[model samples]
Target: MLGLTQSQEKGSDDTIDDLPQWRRVIPVALGLCLAFALALLFVLANRAADDREDALGNQRRSYEVIAIARNLEGTVARAESLLARYVVSVDAKDGQRYSDQWRLAGTLIENLRRSSRDDPDKLRYIGLLRDSYAARGKTLNDIALRTTYDQRLGALGRLYEANRTRDADRIQRILTVIIGHEMKRLNERSTLLDRSTMRADRLAGSYGLVGVVLLVAALVALWVANSAFTERRYARRLADSEARRVDHLELAVQNRTRELEVANGRLRTEMEERAQAEESLRQLHKMEAVGQLTGGIAHDFNNMLAVVIGGLELARRRISGRGDTGGATTNVGTSGVGTGGKSEHGRDTDDAVRHIDNAMEGANRAASLTRRLLAFARAEPLLPAEVDANQMIQGMSELIDRTIGDQIHIVMEPGAEDWRLWADRHQLENALLNLCVNARDAMDGKGTITLSSGQVTLRPGEINDCPGGDYVRLSVRDTGHGMTPDVLSRVFEPFFTTKPVGKGTGLGLSQVFGYIGSCGGEIRILSKPEQGTEVQIFLPRSQRSGEREASRLLTEAAMAPAAPRRSVFVVEDDPRVLAATVAALEELGHHSVSCDHPAQAADLLAQYPGTDIILTDVQMPEMTGPEMIAQMRARGIALPVLFVTGFAGDDAEAGLLDNEHVLRKPFTLAQLDRKIAEASSAPARGHKEAAA
Candidate 1:
């Protein structure tokens, strides 16, 4: 029995040794399975993260492209505004600004080209945008070049007549289309981002659940194994590593979500700003329309004033018994009374003269008012000449005293003797008179008005909208209740007035502003409540002198040695004006042939082959005076022509009328006689053709 028990114990020892080897194999297999599952989960998480990152990158690119397009649109708008301002102000700085903005827009287009390379449709649109921008840029460049070469009138006409649909409007439409496309892309990207995030979340959840199931199965296997403590320790370390990886992935996704939110916020802000900008553009367009309307009204008003003034002057001459008998073909008598200033109807001569004088004064005032309107409209016919400001101020001292009243003290502060300005002397005088009148009113006709002048060297950026150069500065200051900031800001605006109704025309400062700008000058006003006001005008300094002498000589030549009586052919559209013109020519001791239409001028000239001078109105129905002249030239009729106009604003026909003598409307008989003499001395149109 003892021997049998010993053999059984040895067999039991062998079985125990085999059980340990099997135990080691079971734990190693479980570890391998756990590692494989972790590896698969890692790969799935990494793929989800990469897909989300790609979606985010695409969204960012869409935002960048859209922003760039909007910026490019704004740049184009700024460039156009600068070009328009240059046309009006003729300021070189504005032109330079336009060029700079245009270049920036080009750079933006290049950026767009780069941004849209991945999208075939966007690339095609980009190409179209670039081509359109290049064409538009070429047009603008031509305009700027013409303006630079002093072809301002032609440049302005071309600019105003530019085909918006083909150029600017087309560009805008393309930009809108581009923006809309990008907006669609943005929406798609947003949807993609949401889907990517959701997919990542689902992938993470499914993988996590699989990992947990694998972990639980490994734990259950470990619990049954003989090496349970070692297996459990290994499994715990792996679970900890997996937990850290999941936390890191969740943090990364949250960060991406915040980034997308930030980009969306920025887009919203840009959209609001663009809305405000569009509103401002609309306001500017409205103001431009008002300016055009004002100019048109002023032009028509000037023509009517011309007729009224001419009729009144002719009536006064007839009543004064100064009418001549050389060409009394009109219904009105052209015969002078015998040494007695009496009418043919036996009316009281002195009373008629006084009433006529009062009427003449009223008409003259109306003429002055019309001139102010013309100046404000920037359509005033400027006759620029070199002027000595000191001399002019001195000459106007007596007139200024009488106009401003004795109660108001006038202080003249003249600059250096060599300081001179190249401007229209008459317009300059009108500007000064307007300033003085404004000052007198501001001070209630009792304060000191200082008229000062000096030379100044201006640097770039020192003055607003003015170039760097040597300038002659004229300042008109008044000691009175000064303007508020609100009023001062709007003082240069046309038709804006602070005075009571009928007390001021509201065009004084605006006319002065236009005149200064037209003369290549700038005006600045400084004032504060109760601190008095100072109006400073800076005009370009003249490089030449002896202008006064030249002007006086020309005036004398026009007035001296009036041409002998000859047949004058007059073309007028208004019958009343035609009758007055014929009567005036008769009174000037010159025979007249009158036609009421420009179309009839050629026929009239045909009948009257001995016509010495052709005097025609510039703006006529059916055909313009210049057009009529061109037709006559085409027919080989090279008669010397004289243009009579109320407002010489036909800059398109400026080339045709450049060499032709022009006489402004509401002209006196002496002015008429002088113009006739000047026209008679001019070479025929054939001479101009030959010279050309």
Candidate 2:
């Protein structure tokens, strides 16, 4: 009996083995196809439903419009009827009714006019009704306003005589035309609504039939697959029965052992993956929270700095704001020197200026630290312009050379290769030099740091984390030990560093990332363990401003030589800064008006209207300096505005270093004066149409 069962099972196994591999996947394929068909059917049904709803809505609106038109006609007729009665009986009651009906008619006509637009012809009808209502309203007012019975009757008879003379006929004819036109629109919408309903029904029926057919076919496929599965199960059971009397215990033992091993491996893999994902998620959340907190404090801290610096400036001015009338320049080299030579008082004031300057320098450095912190926090705004990459790099060569020290060899690519990139010049230079310094440190200040530039065009998807464009590439490569993959991965993370503690802030790479990202640029790190590291920055190439010749004519106006600009309107909410600015202006041989508020500056501008330059703080109680300038422009005051703020805000108020109107806090008298010069020379005040 055992041999016979084995033979039968062997035959069944052979038959199952002969089936094609594709046969096993047939049910899944059919199910997927049917799911797609059902999905398409749902979309069709949704579209049909939307169309039906829209048609029905239009029909309802048409009905409402038709009803309103009829009501308007009734009100007009009622007014006309009451007027005729008042004319016949000369009664005050009739006159009142006439007045009320006329008012109601006018209201109804306006309501209809507002709601009547279904087509151009419907609009025309509403306009006609409005015109007729106007004519009728005039006549009705004449009749209703007469206080005496005799006067009321006389007005009504006059209206009646006018009605006989074709005016009333013209008005009624208009009403008739409008009502008929609305009714026509109503019928059209009703017909469309019915047609849409019929089309939707037909479509539903068609899709329903197709869906049923697909479902039937899918069910037949499922049944066939189930039959095959059942046959295979039976064959396995037959084989198991044959083996039961032989080595069944051993087979069960091995099968259980293999199953346990697979389950253990899968569980371990899932646990490790889950742990990694959770850790990454936690770190990301922590960074985001820290960034938000830092960004919020930065703005408020800048405001405090403005107050601090503004006070120091004012105090310095009070102590040392003496005039050198005899062309003896101040120690700061600012113009307007007093005639007196170096006296004991002058020496004390000069010492005071030095002390103040030292304080200002330290404050300005603190401000710079705050700015870097902001950049690391990704809160700084970039004001990008068409910048010549060669010019920018060349300008920074000396600073880069000084900062990296004598141990490092700095090599610039020979010749001035002209390529323009749209970038915030200051931020880009900072990021570039930062990368160079980082490379210098990597080389232990002993290797060559090659600075080079070139242009390349990239197609879409070539560079990761960047939009593809023709880019001006700036590269800083060093002959230093490169980073391993593990270290390189965290290179741009804030506060993540490979250096020993107290040696690095870990914000250098982060700031580079932030500034470049803000300018729509991308950073590339090519490094491996032990090999030299190379960092490439890619900034999108931009067209030169205006024509090439015109761009060549363009100069950094703020840096050019100019005379002392006078007639200054100083706007600062901080009293110290206000006083400092006023004194500074006067000390520089310029006339100035002090405003404790930005609104006061606006008032001053309005009152004088001939102010040369507006020196203002960015943040104040009533309004920001930018707001003051905007308000002044709105009032047709086209005066020059120089926005001085302690800290940067959003992109709108963030000042470019080259912006003449924007000065940072803790600035020297010379810096303040230079800004005034730049503002006075700016052509923004050329808008001659002043605000009234």
Candidate 3:
């Protein structure tokens, strides 16, 4: 019995040794399983992240492509608009702008091509868009070339034809298709991104649960082992390792999220920049259109004012016995003048004359307003001459007093005696008058307006954009309510006014600004909330003694005897203007022959080869007056030409006939007589020279 008991004890000891080995194996196996699970989860998570990133990248690319396509459409539209304006204005700047915008469109197309390189379908659309844009670009180029060659009418016609044909529409449609395709791709990628994110979330949750289960299994296995203490230490070490792996996964996710945020920030910035560019383009277009519109309306308005002013002056002369009948029968027509001899009712005639004078005053004021509009549009033809600022202000003092009313006081601070400037004298007077009127309005017609002038030497950056030079500074300061910073900043903007509607035209300051700029000068305004406003006009100093020469010419013309009667061929388009001009010529003691069309003027001149002078309108249908004159010169009919126009376009077009004399419409009889004398006395040019 002792030997058997010893044998059982030996077997128990061997089993015990084997049990310790099993405990080590079980814990090690559990740790290995946990490690494999964590590694596999990490790999899966990394793969899911990569897939999401790819989806996001695709979405971002699609958005970029879409934005580019939209911008390309807008660029093409802007280019076409500029081309139309170029045709209308015949401006070199507008033509250059069109070319720039078209080139920018080409660049956008290239960007679209690059963005769509990965998609065969999108690439095909881009190719189509490119071809269409190229075709349109060629058409626009032809129009611009025509305009550059001075074929404005032909260019305008072609532009209208292109619009009717919807050439630009094809480009728009192609862009729409491109944008739509990108949007679809973007939506699909977004859906994929959402699915990937959800899958990653689910995988993470599953991996976390599995890891927890594995951790519990490892702890239970360690507790069940024979050598629990050593096994527990090993299990704790495995748990720590698993936790570190989880930390590593979380860190990688945070890094990816930060990268996404940075990319999104860049995208937002790009979108904002694009928006700002679009807004600036829109503002430019709006201002350009407004200027063109203002010019057109002012042109037509001037023509009507000519008829009114001319008719009124004719009526006044007849009633007041100022008409130089010169023993010739007067044919006044429907100009509110009687065809009989002087009326015996002298008092009634005096009343009639006074009424006509009042009418003339109002008509002249309307004409002045149109001149301001033309000036603002940069379309007025400026006849610049040397001017003495002090003399001009002195001469205008009385007119300013009468214009500003008795309540407002006028203070004159004349500048140097030799402070002369080269500018349009009449326009300068109008500018001063406008400033005085604005001051009077600002002060509610009851404040002191100091009109000061002096010679100033300006340095670079010393004043409002005036170059370093000697300038005649003319200031109009008023003790009135001043302007805020916001109002002051925009004071020079056209059609911007702080006054109530109808109280002001909003063009007072704008006209001053444009006129000053045209004279190669600068204008500055200084104002405070309650300190009153001061407007300073800096006109470039002229070296010539224009004031004395101008006075001499005026004295000579005014003192000179009446011109001899001669045959005047008047070429006018409007019948009313034609009749009014004929009456004025007759009133000036000259025989007048009238033709309503420029095309007929050449034939009429040939028929009346004894014509002493040619009086023609500048702009007419079928042919311009200069063109007709050229034709006449071609046929060896170079009688001195006098151009009559209400709106003579810009300075370049106004001076088209360099050798010919120009007489603005809405003229007084004296002005008409003076211009006629000037035209007749201007040495006639040979046909060859005139045509050239």
Candidate 4:
């Protein structure tokens, strides 16, 4: 009895396995059959729509031909009338009138021939129109020869006797028959267009109905697919949850076993050390707790320190001046430390001043660190423009070669003509330089780095995988110690680096990835363990101005203008930032009309037009600066505008960053100075068109 029950259970398990196979096969068969039917239906519907459109086109062409034929007939009639008048004028002995009518009739016939040149039916009518005109001309010529200046009355008599009137009547009859034939052809075309339109309407209605049916089918398929996907996801989640639970239970059991083993070992050790280690154990426990607390604090401090140091460094570098580079010592007297504050006691006072200076130095270092982190994250707004990729590559080659050292051969193969790609040129240059440096480091300063750029046209299928289009490819190939497959896979992953300690931050590749992605471009890496790595970036090409010269403003003032001396209103909230901004403006030769907030700037704008341009930060405390610009414009102070801000959100102002009129922040004093002058130029005096 026990053997029989086991056999029954074994058979039931086999049946369960077989049930899945049948279920899969049934759905797969149904799916394939439905897909095949849908494909056939699509092809048939497209073909029918194409056929109907072709038929409508044929009817339209037929109508055009008939209309042209009718026009030819009318022209022929006008020629006949003019020829009859010419004959009558000659018979009456009026040479001027006869010559005028003859010339007019000739023009009408030529026009008719030219008009019907393309259509076969119209060309046939044109031929008849020409014949009738020629016949009339011949009859007129006979009359003109018969008439003479000496015998005026006899000329009139001879002109009538020549039967020119009879020939004119014959031409008119021909024109009438031609016009009738054209009218019949026009009627036929009208019938055809009517029938074609009706047929097209019927086909359109049928196609719409079919489209509705297809749409319903598509909706049903989507519903089924979504249902299946949801079921699969639910199953996966359940599986994952069960796996995680099992793993947790297993880990707990292992941990408990480890604790037991440690306890047993300690028990054996305790017997040996019972009389000699009470103080040591107490000290060890205290050290462990302190270490954990210290580690937690250090981690938090490290993150904050990164932000502060990065921000200050960015601000300091972007700030322009002569002595700003060699630390704050050179500017101690001239930049605003009082004479009384100078040290007379050499060591004590010196130490006091040194501490304050050290504190300031610490703040600056912290800001610098934050800015670097921000750059890696791409939190700053990028100013993208249509750049000539070849020019930029060529321009950076010399700098790159120098930085990588003379031992490394840095080769640049830029395309002959300009390849326009939309990206921030400065950021792109930085990315390229970073890659070159990395390559140099990989080779230990002795390998070949080839930087090549060219344009590429992608086909529909190829681009679809990449969200594709025409792209400009910039490839960098290095003969260096290439990364292994495992390393290459995690190359762009943030904070993943294989460099020796103190040599890298692991953010270089991450920054490159972010910048390329921001510009709607893609980067691909191909590497082998001992061979080489090829990093290629595909940047979408700007199609509008292909092969044309970049419309870079020709005037020096437009591109890089002189410093502004006129009054300008500046608005920002950060205190140290405000002071730094004011100092930068003064150095730029600007008489700054300064405010700490946008509201104050708005009030100042309302009070002054001598304020040539408005320079304001976007993210302000009381009111946003964009709103302030709108308010200034409303208040009739439509002075030229410029924005200096670090806020780079996807908003209206971010979109305007591409325009020359909108300047981005962390700007140099020189850049701010240049923009101010350009915006503050006097308006043109008159409305007269200037000489080119």
Candidate 5:
């Protein structure tokens, strides 16, 4: 899931199957060309426009200077017209005023001549004309200067008139020269205009070319837009196809998920069935081992019993016959009866009897030990009940503390009154005691053991490495020499032990494990060497009321015989146990036949049809006891078979005990009697099918 999130953020696509190679290059090339061409065109047009603007400005300035010269001449002529006509001729009558006027007119005419003198013809004519006018002006001025009589006045007047006429002729010559020059200049200007018109035509041609390029660019832009639209259409199709592929992929994934779910469900069912079959096999194997061990123990006990019975009978008969040994009573006091407690010889007899009684007591203890071993192996049914776990701890506290000796202190941390658990009371107690003993041994009986109980609610997905459920937890904590990591790692392994020889039976913890597992509970251990150790047992809550009621019935049954003895056919591959079971059944007042295999018993059943029940060892090398029974039932033999098993590999013996008539290894004569009676009291129940 995290990987999926990261992949989404990175925009990774799994589906890009068909992409065109050419689609990538066209747009990139087109964009670069367009940009470069546009930049180059802008630079060229800007330079051309700047050059044209400069040329036009220079031509306008030249025209403006010419116009300024023409305007100055007109201004002077207007002023001359006003001065000559106005003022009532006051300045005309005065020589000085007249001289000033003539000087102004001469300067004005000189300026006009010079301004128009750029043309070669105009310069020569204007110069000649100016010289003629100067001479005329001099003549007139001389006449005006004359101081004579009337004749002289008349002469002076004639000269003035002649000079005036000459000046007029010169002025006309100057006007003609100026006008010709103006006309020649106008022709030159027309030539310049013709050149400008040619340049304008060339400019118009270039502008038309620019307009054509602009039209081409517009057309290219339209084509590019159309190409882009086509490309967009192609891209849209690709996107749509990719989207459809994704949808198909999603649908396929959903189908695969459904298939996977169905597979998982089938696997779960198979696993449950496998577990039940495995457990049954384990129980059967345990029962077979028990049968062998029980036969051996029983055989040995029976031999001892034979010696005792024979010796007691011989002694009784000898006493009844009144046989006296020589001086056997000589140690009796002289008063005919011993008064000093007893004579030395008499004390010896009493001592022999005590030894015999002690031997019998040891035998009884061995039988009791056998019963417990069988119970742990699951040969017997569990009696479950609602129990205050804290109270149970309190009840067992003294015994557990005593077992560890005074070196270790045992503490009971009782939970509040609300703490309750449902389980087999005896089995639970045994499990707790086993843990306490294990803790005590780990501590070498010198530390403290605390037994505590509590209830816990588990949330979903929180397993504590155990299956999730409402559980009552009973924990045993010890301040003993704890287990190292290496030791702890394999602590739960069957037959694993660290204790010195004869100090421990490795079955202690294995039994606890099996019992808890069988009850749908779990056990966990935590330990660190030199620090401490704690073992927690978690049992799921039970809601069934029958377990509680059944518990009471079991307790009462344990007190007395709940079954009656009947004829039994005991089948075993081991000679010792077969003989022992036969002997034990005989002692228990039942008719019994002993065989080394269920096959042998099968033959007997065919021949006699008188065997009331079959008691068989489960794990035989040739054929398992359950398999033998299955074979027998197939053959129409209807006798019920009770299995006898040992605690070894009890997990493999569960199937044999499913018949509810198995006796565990090293059982007392009483347990064998009970099982045989249970088998004979009812018609044989059919074999249970393996759980599906």
Candidate 6:
């Protein structure tokens, strides 16, 4: 097939070069000239049609104005006739009909006034018409409310004499004068409109004649062009068919050429695939290395935080407990032992407690930063609730003010009624505080922070890049120095900041962005250099229930009466945290058996079978807290156990971390007491059910 096609293509090509080129040029040139003439003629015809349409439009407007003027005159005459008829007959029906006519007249007059508002002369006459109508209406109202004809029969002659000089008669005379003046002006306008319309008709006819002449000339030129092309066609028909056969042969040759190219392309593609596979392997190895580094660093860092935080709490207790008589060191923030406990040793206890409190504050802040890092790493889980954003803002009002200090002003704006938001309340507060603090720094501690919450609707291709639906929009606008485009672009990038070292972790806004995204919300920032910045976050509206009921139960349990003191078995791998837990439980008026390992705690659990609760660490060397409890339960130990962990556990770990029994790490003494109370009560209910 290839050999036959090549032979035919060569034969056709050898015979085609003999045709004359002049055969094609003459028709193409004539056709172009013909097209230009026809296009010109089309343009001229359209222009004439447009002119005729515009003239007709003007004529129609003139007719509308004349019709309105005549209607105005008729409305006035109708009202006058009805008014006179009612006065003569003194019939209630006639008077009501007259009132209706008066209202219709007022409407017609107002229509005229609006149409002619730009005309000074027409405006003056419309004003006169309104005044005359009002005066006549008042006089007629007085007459309508007056006595009947029979009651006024004795004074009928005197009333008739007085009615001649009344305001109604004067108003009637003025209306007649106004109507006459308007009719004259309307006639003059109609005359001028007729003249303009006639002139427009003449101009349209002239334009149409010129257009027809152009059309005929363009047709003649096109006929000439067609004749010239036909004459040239006679000279080229035989050669054109021969050239077309040659083109077909050339097209077949191209098909075989493309087939040859395909085999080469396939070879190149295989080589490219091999290269891509090698690159992918490298990328996989890099990701594995990064994951190992990140996980190891996080685990080691959290263990160190636990040690530091636990040691501070223990040392502060011992120093203050020795001189902590009368609970002088019990004041968490304001326990100036110098002010109240004036003993020498009491002052030392106060200093120790204050220093530890500051250290604890720093540790807590570091813990918060760690939480953000975990969140960004997708290792943390959120405890979202059906929270009313407005109420949340109000709850944090005082805390925000104090955090921002007295140099700045704070404003709280509530959302609309009944709008519900779904988010973690504590994380949302932290994000808000971070924004406020950033705002304060931008203003150099001397500006205002505006916090607002409201329900907003977003549409596809509208405000806030989100799916079209209802959303809760919370905004933090600051009257402080803003950021440039470059800074704004990277504001939500982890570890990117413009703040000086030691001043910012640079994870504040990034955490906010990640957390909002995790909750199916979007955060947007608007900023300009030297101007202020506005951060707006939009969360999807929720109709979730059962959340509030669960929250209420937790609150009630936390604040309700303390549970009875009983033995607590504690298991922890960290000795410091384990010691702190035992001391906290003992301080809260309970006996505690503490163990540094799960094996020891299990032995203690076996010996002391009368224990009320077991508080255990989540990640232990011998066994995790959940694993140990499962072992005990396998042996038929049905006591309620609380699993405490510093890490943000996953969904499978949720059964152990039921907000009531599972205490998070770095919890205070008060938190321990509350958890114990709640945990003790949960088991007591189960025992009562068993007895029943």
Candidate number achieving the greatest lDDT relative to the actual structure = 3
Q: What is candidate 4's lDDT per residue for 584-692, written digit by digit as tens?
A: 6665456777788777776766677577667776667667777777666565555666776554443354654444355444454455655666556634211132222
TM-score, candidate number 1: 0.55
Per-model TM against the reference: 0.55, 0.43, 0.56, 0.37, 0.37, 0.42
Best by TM-score: 3
Against the unseen true structure, what C-alpha lDDT does each candidate score?
Answer: 0.74, 0.67, 0.76, 0.58, 0.58, 0.64
Which residue runs of candidate 3 sit more than 4 Å off their true CA positions? 1-301, 315-344, 376-378, 386-420, 425-451, 455-470, 478-517, 524-533, 541-559, 650-652, 655-660, 686-692
RMSD of 3: 12.6
How do the residues 89-177 of candidate 3 rate in per-residue lDDT, one tens digit apiece? 57789889889989999999999999889999989988988898888888889989998997654665676567668665999898888
Q: How far is candidate 6 from the true structure (C-alpha RMSD, Å)?
A: 35.5
lDDT of 2 by residue, 431-504 (tens): 77788889988888798998888888877778786777788998898999999989988898755667764466
Write the residue-wise lDDT of candidate 5 on 373-424 in tens digits.
Answer: 4444444346455777778888777657666688888788876355566676
Score residue 350 of candidate 4 by CA lDDT.
46
Scored by Cα lDDT, where does model 4 land?
0.58
**Which candidate, 1 or 5, would have the higher lDDT against the true structure?**
1
Question: Which runs of model 6 end up more than 4 angstroms from their true locations?
Answer: 1-301, 314-343, 385-421, 425-453, 456-471, 475-537, 540-562, 599-604, 649-660, 683-692
| lDDT of model 6, residue 388 | 88
Q: How well does candidate 3 score on lDDT at residue 324? A: 66
Q: What is the lDDT of residue 6 in candidate 4?
A: 92
Q: What would the per-residue lDDT of candidate 6 be over residues 256-346, giving only the tens digit for each residue?
A: 4464366447535644543333333334345445544554555556666766776676677666553232234443333445565466655
Residues 1-692, model 1: lDDT tens digits: 78778877877777766688768787788677766655665566556666766777787677778768877877787787778767655789999999999999999999999988999998888889989999899888898999899876567656765633457677778989998999999899878867877776665555545545555776643333323334334434544554465466557546655754665575466445444333333443454466566657766766676667667777777776655444333323222665454466445555676787898788777665566555545465665668888887776677689789999999998984688989877678778878988988888879999998888999976879899998999889999999998999989864467876445545568768877888989999999999899999999999775756664566677655454787989999888778878887887778899998888788778988888888998878798898998888887787788898776664465556676788876777777877787778667776566345
RMSD of each: 10.6, 32.7, 12.6, 41.8, 52.5, 35.5
Tell me how far the alpha carbon of residue 46 in candidate 6 is from the true structure, in angstroms, after superposition.
Answer: 84
